[model samples]
Target: MSKRIFVGYATKTGSTKETAEAIAKTLSGRGFGVDVKPFAQAGDLGAYDGFVLGAPVNGMAWHPDASAFVRANASTLAAKPTAYFLLSLAYGVGRASMKRAIPARLAPSSALAKPVATACFGGVIATEPPIVLRLLFGIKKGSPRDSRNWDDIHAFAEGLAAKLAPR
Candidate 1:
């Protein structure tokens, strides 16, 4: 039987959900049974052989639900082959910037259990963000756009498939 994998995410403006879907699609293409869902709807971790959790950076941290999920399931995650991905504008700037910033952003999740694989990808700016965010990020209206790299996202998923393949 094919191994079953779950891809769960917490998205503020849907970017993380899209990333999780892409990861699930790639894993499915690799012959694994995969299911992608928002973190709240992911049900139980006990049903899957492996897992992937994704979240976008908000104030240099993961969405609360994603961190909560990791904390709640730390033991199960540590026992399985698990991966993590983050969506952040820092990635568009450069890897060095991302590397320097990731530890604090990932502290909540990593504190629970270390992921077998990790990836960082650029984020999207919604066409219309709340006024507070616009001022905070210096994003002008109409400048909202995506910077995610599909090729990199797919490559990360492929690597994850290889990692989760039966030994």
Candidate 2:
């Protein structure tokens, strides 16, 4: 039987969901049985052989659902091959800046279960921010943009598949 993997994600603007699906698709092509689902919809973790969890950084932290899922499933995660991916506006800030920013954002999850691999991907900004957020962040409607690197995402997924492959 093929190894079973689950890719769970939480997203506000949809970039993270796309990321999870891309990883699932890649892993499926590599011969794993992959399932992609929202964090809220994820059921028991024990049935999966490995996991790929992803979420967007809303402020300095991950979306609450993603963090909660990690905390709730830490035991199972620690016993298996687990990877994490984060979508953040910081990734758009340049490589050095992103390198400096990643640890802080990952701290919470790392404390729960040490991921076998981790990746940070650039985020897509809402074309029109809510009035309050726009005023707070000084972003004009349609000003910010999507900075996701598809190649980087694919490479990360490929690497994850390799790591999970049986020897």
Candidate 3:
């Protein structure tokens, strides 16, 4: 039987969900049974063999919903082959310091489950900044830009599949 994997994500906008979908598609293509869902609807994790958890980076930290999920499921996650991915403008549109903060920001999640892999992807900004951006960065308006690198995203998923492949 193919291994079952859960791809659960939280998004302030929708970039993280989109990234999670892409990850799920790649994992499915590589012969795994993948289920994609939002963090709030992550039911019965024990039914899955592995996990791919993702969330957006906001206010220089992992989204609270994803962090809370990690905290709540740390025990189950630590016992499974798990990976994490984050989406953020820091990926391609921010200063080096912001980019440098990604690992530190991800430390909380990794400290819990010690994932097999972790990735950070560039995020998409809509024509109007989302509330999170306005509240966090005080950006009231902006041009839309999609900075996601499909090659990097696909590669991250492929590499994660390799790491989590059964013996």
Candidate 4:
């Protein structure tokens, strides 16, 4: 059977989706079949050989749907090789904020799954949106910052692929 790699992401305005797509593309280029899906739509993990979970930080924690997915699938996840990525504003901040904000934890199941290689990427902060939508959602835009380190992300993906490849 073809090796299957599943990428599950939680995105607010698409940054997380982009990051997941990048990883999926890289893995697919290496010959693995990749299935990319939002966390809510992702179903059983039993069919995949490996997994990549990506999420954005909001109010200092993972998005609820991502967390819920982890909680719901922890057992199945624990049986496979998995990795995680976090997108947040802490990327450009000084050492203190970076230390506190980055390296957010994955759900327990993911942690228990094969050792999880993780990446912390800087995310986009939308400056303006429709006022009505922002008001209804209580959205507050953060300052624009390029916090993503493409080199780091690429390295992490490469390393994870290497680790998950057939022995």
The per-model lDDT (C-alpha) reads 0.81, 0.81, 0.84, 0.71
What tens digits encode model 2's per-residue C-alpha lDDT throughout 36-152?
999888887777889899998887688888889989889888788888889876565334544466557878887898888998887787655566655544444565578688999
* Each prediction's TM-score versus the true structure: 0.84, 0.85, 0.88, 0.80
Model 1 per-residue lDDT tens digits across residues 1-167: 99999899998888888889988998999999998998889887788999899998887787788888899999998788888889886554334645467547876687688888888887887555566765555545665378798999999999998787543
Error of 2 at 140 (Å): 12
Best by lDDT: 3
How well does candidate 3 match the true structure in TM-score terms?
0.88
Candidate scoring better on lDDT of 2 and 3: 3
Point out where model 2 deviates above 4 Å.
Answer: 94-99, 128-144
lDDT accuracy of residue 87 in candidate 4: 85
Scored by Cα lDDT, where does model 2 land? Answer: 0.81
Model 3 CA lDDT for position 12: 75
Model 4 is weakest, by summed lDDT over 10 consecutive residues, at 134-143
Off by over 4 Å in 4: 107-114, 128-144
Model 1 lDDT on a 0 to 1 scale: 0.81
- As a whole number from 0 to 100, the lDDT of residue 143 in candidate 1 is 52
Error of 1 at 37 (Å): 0.4
CA lDDT, candidate 2, residue 132: 69
Model 3 per-residue lDDT tens digits across residues 31-126 = 999999998999999998898999888878889998899999999988889898888876655556666666677898899988999988877877
Q: Summarize candidate 4's per-residue lDDT along 17-111 as a digit string, tens digits.
A: 98888888888888889999998787777778988888887765777777777677776766677777788764433245444545645444345
Candidate 1's error at 84, in angstroms? 0.6
